[model samples]
Target: MTDATSRDGTRSGSTAQPVGGAKGPDELRRQIEQTRGELGDTVEELAGKADVKGRAKARAADLKDRAGAMTVHLRGSAGHTVRGGAGRADPPSRRARHAVRAGLGHPRAVLVAGAAAGVAVAASLARRHRHGPC
Candidate 1:
């Protein structure tokens, strides 16, 4: 079987080089600007063809219908959640408070509380020093 190397001693799968050097940053920026200008013109042409008043009315009706549907869905979901949550022995408010207390009991929470206390103490000391030991 023949090896994969080409007749020119380069790898057969390698790409051929471009005729010119790579484009510089300024040329690249110009190309990007040209493309953006063309795209902007295309968008403006498309926007001009649309019927503004009719489109606005249709969009407003669509949004209103969607909002009404969403309100009904959320109301049903909230009712279900409240009913399900209420069936538990612990009341929702008490349960939430207990959860918050438990979270605050963690080491990270204690560390954050300690840091805040330290800042407050330092600020108070600085104020006392500034006011000549009030």
Candidate 2:
């Protein structure tokens, strides 16, 4: 997280390299430009970390993108049933459909989901008490 500084104590932003006996101006200019670009990227990364809302938004956007990609992939693999098309391109087998039907209003599913929610809430409360707000 430290910026590279020159002998004058200003941020030179470049990595330590031997000052050659005869390096050209153009080469130095290119090095300076590269350093500036790297510095800009580092600053942006630090700023992004400090911005809570921005980080949340970025994470949400990334998750949304991943979800969209997954949806596309699932549709391509699972066929027309993904979007309520005219007909199922790859309909579920009868036994599988029956099993799913039997799962309707299943107490096990309810119990598992409820238990997971309870555990999550308990963990969250414990974390809050330990850390005290965020």
lDDT of each: 0.78, 0.79
Cα RMSD of all models vs. native, in order, equals 16.6, 15.7
Q: lDDT score of model 2?
A: 0.79
Best by lDDT: 2
lDDT of 2 by residue, 1-134 (tens): 77665675456445556334128888888878988999999999998889999889989999999999999998787665645665645456876777667677597996788799999999999999999998
For candidate 1, give the lDDT of residue 88.
56
Q: Would you give me the overall lDDT of model 1?
A: 0.78
TM-score of 1: 0.33
lDDT tens readout by residue for model 1, 2-106: 336555554434443233323888876776798799999999888866769877888899999999999999999988987897755677999899978987779
TM-score of each model, in listed order? 0.33, 0.33
